[model samples]
Every structure is written in structure tokens, then in C-alpha cells.
Target: MTIPPGPYSPNPAPLLARALRALRRDTGLPVAFGGPVSRDGRGFVIEQLDGARTTSLLRLRVQAGAGLGGRALALARPWVVDDYFAAEEITHVYDHAVAPEHLRSIAAAPVVVDGAPRAVLYVASRSSVDFGDRLLESVARVVQLVERDLAVEEEGRRRLAAAPPALHSAEVHELVAELSQIAATVQDEGIRRRLVDVCRRTRLLAGRVPSADRSPAPAVAAVRLSPREREVLAEVARGCTNDEVAEALGLLPNTVKSYLKSAMRKLGATNRVQAVNLARAAGALD
Candidate 1:
């Protein structure tokens, strides 16, 4: 399947910036630095820091299970070297990059998303104080925060895609709330716009009428729907059969049937058609 284009896809610059800001706030560390590492079809590159210099610059290139950062990515855990030259656990993949910077004490943590390592967060210090558990904890907290924000955005997108076009004002309002929350937390302009787009679409769908002469339906009160349920209802309102909805939404036909049945029961409708009509009347279908 084609991956949807999103601000979170690549270009780890924003995450790095946020990570650095958090790192700097940790009073325990005299120095901190971070960059993103990726292994893709084009190979590996450390998306360099925007405006910072260090005596020792840690770099990891395309190779499996090599160097401190690469090993962290491979193993999906944080790794640290109190003394880089003396650390005998792994081979230095970027000796050329590390040597010029005079980096000695180093720590690396994988910025994991889902079950895979997407990138690494590395911090280095000149002195050999081991960088400690405090530094690692700080990094983990920052990563969790970032991941939470991403999860919000992802959930909002899923809801928007799943929701039927005939949603009631209440359902639309609920989605708007979710979108607004996601938009507020996201730092990326592109992601923010996408959230806004979802809100606009929800508004449009809710505002529509069965006929020009008929007054626009009253808005539905705010009501939350799970992302999957919203998607199923959205397809149903668009006049799609269960099989069609399932195919479009990447769900089994039985699952789509169950979602529609559940939605019908929740909206207190007798059948699929009534469910759509009542949801519209209740202002939930927008």
C-alpha cells in the first residue's frame, strides 16, 4: 500500500530540535547533542545539526549493527560508552567522523516508533562522567512526548478517513475537537494543515442537506466515535456496500458489517438506511 504523505514521514529536523531543547534543560549535563539516523534505500546520513558545533561529532552511516548509534538502532535500545576509545563492545563505523570532533563519552538511544527503530538520539560529553541514567531518562521522556503527539495526529487522520460523509453536526463537532487538539500539539505546518483540512471536510459534510429546499439539519451534539467506527459509517453514508466499505477501509467484510450493525444500534436505527438517515438527523454523520 502507498504510504500517505505526512509531515512526520521524514526530515527529522523538528524532532531533533525539540530533543536538543530538552537536552539543554537537563542541568546535569555539561554538553548535549542529537541528530537523526535512518537506513533507507538511498543509504544512511546523519541529518546534521542546524547550528551547533562540538569537539567530538558522532556519525553513523549505512551499516547493520556497527558503531554506538547503529547498534542502538539494530538492537532497539539505548547504548552508552563512558570512554569511546576504550569501549570494546562494537566496532567504530564512523571513526573518521568521531576522530575529528574529539568525542569521548557518548550515549545513544533509538527513537523508536511502533516496534521498529526509526532514528537515534545521541548525546556526547567531553568529560568521562558516563553521561549517567539521568540523561537517558530525560531523553526517554522527550521521546515519549513526541510519540504522544504523533499518535494524536495519526488517530485524528484515521477518524477523518473512516467517518461517513453524512455525519451529524455532533459527530462533526467531536471530530473538530480531535483535529484541533492534534493541530495544537503538532509543530509541523504540513501536519497542522492536514488537521485543518479534516476539520473543514467534516464541516462540509455536516452542513449538507438532502435537498436544496430543505433547511440544513440541526447540528448534532458532540459525540466521540472510535476511528474504525467512524470510517465504517463514513463509507456507509456514501452509499457503499459492506464489501466495498471493507475494501476501501482495509477491513474484513465481516468487520465492516459489525461496525455498521454496532453503529445502527448505537444510533437506535432499525436498518442500514435508517441508521444513515437517523445519524444524519442526529447531526452525527457530518
Candidate 2:
């Protein structure tokens, strides 16, 4: 029997690279490297290197439970050694690769999602040094960002796979609603903006069907909506009640109503349904 690869094989290299950069910025580490777990569940091949003295560490496959990185992958936590070669707790299989770089201190943190390690991030220093709480916390924050991004990307891929090529209006609305919920939970500004873009694309995808025979959408005066107002209306367009919209967007029902009213006033809509139709016509909701 053969074991399959880890779920996170071929990890998003760009995301890992960004996180590594963040690690270096926050902790001022001399070198940083990382990669996603391999497809065969064996280990990760180092695909990124930052500030390294040599390329010897690049593309090196660190097996699970063997070296500093591997042990972090196996345990789903961070491990740091002040003296890499002298660290007896970990195996020295990678000393041949590590020693050439003159690295004496190293740390590894696993990017875990839903209890499983998906990738590993490593930082090292040429001089022996102990990592303190502040540095470790910084590393943790960067890893958490990567974990959230990976989870978001994974969910997006799954939904895209399940969606029909031409989504029905109802399906699109559901997708928009789910994306909105996900966007609300995201703390990273960049990731949140990307999610918003995905929501816009989903709406555009639903609007792609041929409409040559249908009457032109009614003319609605151009109007700009505040982000909160637009968010509330987007949920309303999905047939969500004010309370439901509030819950989804993490707002009070009264606040939701205020935003809805403000948007309706701007769109000159007589009611909630009219506001949604007008906003859709004006290309604001999409």
C-alpha cells in the first residue's frame, strides 16, 4: 500500500514567501526558508530562501521528525535550537546541508489548519542565540496569517469546484452570502480585500448569461454607497432578513436597518426589494 500526499502539497508558494518576508521583518532573523508539505506525506522541499549565505538549503527535503523543521511538522508546533548541531533532542540528518551555511541557531513553526500541519516556516541565525517570547510571538502571528489565508484559499477552491459553470441567480446569491461571511471573519486587510474581489467576481459570473431578448434594466440615478451600506444591501439582495444580515455581517439588526435605509435613500428606492433591484441595475451590488 502507498500513502497519499498531505492535503497541503504544492502549498501556495507566493503566500509562504509573503509570510517568510513578514517573519524576517518582524523578528529580524538572518535567514528564513519554508515550503509546503510534500504530496506523499513524507516532508516539505524547501522552496523559498531569504538572506541565506548559500543556496544549499534551497530545495532540500526535510523529512518529518528528523530535523528541526521536520520535528515542528510532526508536532504541529514551533521548535527552536540555540545550537543546531548540539541539539541532541532532534536528529542530525540535515547537518550536512545546514553546516555549510554557518547557521548555529534555528527555529521552525508549522502552518497548521484544522489541527493538521500543512507547511513549515524556518528562521535561522549565523550566531547562536535563544529565541525569546517576543520573537516567538511574532513568528506565531505570521504563521496564523498564513494559516487563515490557506484556509480561505482552500474553501474558495472547493466552492469553485462545486459550482456550476454558469451559476443560477440563487446559487450566486448563496455564494456571495458565504463569501461575505468569510470576509467578515478575516482580520488581514489584504485577504479581506481579495475576498471582496472574489465576491464581485461571483456576481459577475452570474451576470454572464445572454440577455439579448430581455428588456434593458431600468435607469437608476448614479449613487455611491458606503461600504457598510453596500454590504448590508448585498445580503438583502440574497433575500436575507435584516436580522439575518446583521448576524452574517456582525452588525446589530438596528444598524443593519440604518444602513439599508441610507442605501435606499441614496438609490431613491421605495422599499427593500426596489433598493436591491436599483442597486443591481446601477452596478453597485455586483
RMSD of each: 13.1, 7.3
lDDT of 2 at 33: 91
Report model 1's TM-score to 2 decimal places.
Answer: 0.58
TM-score of 2: 0.71
lDDT of 2 at 36: 78
Model 1 regions lying over 4 Å from their true place: 1-12, 27-44, 54-60, 164-170, 181-286
Candidate number of the best lDDT: 2
Query: Model 2: how large is the Cα RMSD against the reference?
Result: 7.3
Q: Per-residue lDDT for 58-96 in model 1, tens only? A: 343545477877677677787889988889997866777
Residue-wise lDDT of candidate 2 within 121-193, one digit each (tens)?
9988899776999889989999999998778766765675578776665567567667666666655556566
lDDT, residue 63, model 1: 52
Which RMSD does model 1 reach against the true structure?
13.1
